[model samples]
Target: MTRSLPLLAALLALVATTPLHAEGDPESGQRVFNQCRACHVIENDGRNGVGPNLHGVVGRRAASIGTFRYSANMRELGEQGLVWTEDNLRAYLANPKAVVPRGSMAFPGLRNPAQVEDVIAFLKSRAG
Candidate 1:
């Protein structure tokens, strides 16, 4: 019993320290991504649209897609070593202008947090 208790405690500690998965639904995120289709593509071989192709974008350095022309601000951000982690994506999606004041992406923003989360989940799903 004493040995089991320590094992159980260690297991609990490991679980507690592990990052919790984001609660967004990837299926729902696909639906949400419909709104982004005019500009972005996530397929591995997808061509750049108004926005750059987003394959493997989840951890990619921002504005690094070679064929797409990025705004000076976007390029600057990338040069500064900004990787597109989930939290960074969330903030940028919530307010493009605020995140990169002169970025060329014209969309206003995703005002709904759930929608933002969903879109991010969709993007992450395609990141492989």
Candidate 2:
């Protein structure tokens, strides 16, 4: 019973640490991505629209794209080593300014947590 207790605790710990968007649906994400199409692109040969090309954005550092101009807040965060991990992306998708306090993203943010997760999944799919 003591051994089982330890295992249960470990399992609970893992679940607690897991990101909530771990199971985001890529197909749903693609559909939701339409909302972002006005400013971002995900195609391999996609060009920078109003925002930077998101071809490999999932694992990239913030504001790392050379051609696109980033707000000072994003650039500074990049310089400070802000990689786009799922947790970070989730937070940013929920509230851009929350992650980059002085950010310039005009889009308010996704209110539905599922929509945010879907968008992250879509971006990750495009990363491949």
Candidate 3:
């Protein structure tokens, strides 16, 4: 039992250091983000396409991009303080309309949970 303590400690340390959104591969996420290319871009200082620019979007407030117009509901959510946390992103990605009924975004949703995680991971990578 004593011999295993060091291993356990090492594992715990790794868990503590790993980011919360590190479950998915950033590279895989980049590819997955291709699905969003039609409406959004994620590069640093990228411009908004059909959808709002997603650079540094993971922790940003909804409808807060002053350059892009958003639906009233989205603006209201921002007024209500809707920060785009990872979990919230997951929910919205799974069902945009369900999360924000009457929003103008038309992409239905990504049904694959893994793909959603990948996209979130990709977005997080863009934050830096």
Candidate 4:
């Protein structure tokens, strides 16, 4: 029993330190995204509110929304062929400026890792 204790502790430590990726629930994410609706809309009709709609953002090319003008940095990313992938979305939600420096996405970023994951999941479901 004494020898097994140390091995079990080591395994627990390993699990604790592992990085978590977003495997968000679409419904949960939609609920959580309610906080975002005031500033942004997710429908695809090009409604032109304060922020751009997010309906098909996941796989859609960055800065490709014809009506909305994007920041220079975002345009560059699109030019560079940087499509929004799951991992990239996770990182961007964690810190948007870090992912697209000088871009205009002024969201403070979701503080909860799980929420970020959830949002990604929701977006993925709507993506083309």
RMSD per candidate (Å) reads 5.4, 3.7, 4.7, 3.5
Candidate 3 TM-score versus the reference: 0.81
lDDT of each: 0.89, 0.89, 0.90, 0.82
For candidate 2, the TM-score is 0.83
Candidate 4 structure quality by residue, lDDT tens digits, 16-101: 98766636799999998897787677876747566668888787777787788788899999899888777787788889998898
As for lDDT, the candidate ahead, 1 or 4, is 1
Worst lDDT run of 10 residues, candidate 3, spans 18-27
lDDT of each residue in 21-73, candidate 2, tens digit only = 55789899999889889998888877899998998899899899889999998
In model 2, what is the error at residue 85, expressed in angstroms? Answer: 0.5
TM-score, each model? 0.81, 0.83, 0.81, 0.78
Error of 2 at 116 (Å): 1.3
Q: Native-vs-model 3 lDDT? A: 0.90
Best by lDDT, which number? Answer: 3
Ranking by TM-score: 2, 1, 3, 4
Task: Give lDDT: candidate 4, residue 61.
Answer: 76
Q: Locate the minimum summed-lDDT window of 10 residues in model 2.
A: 17-26
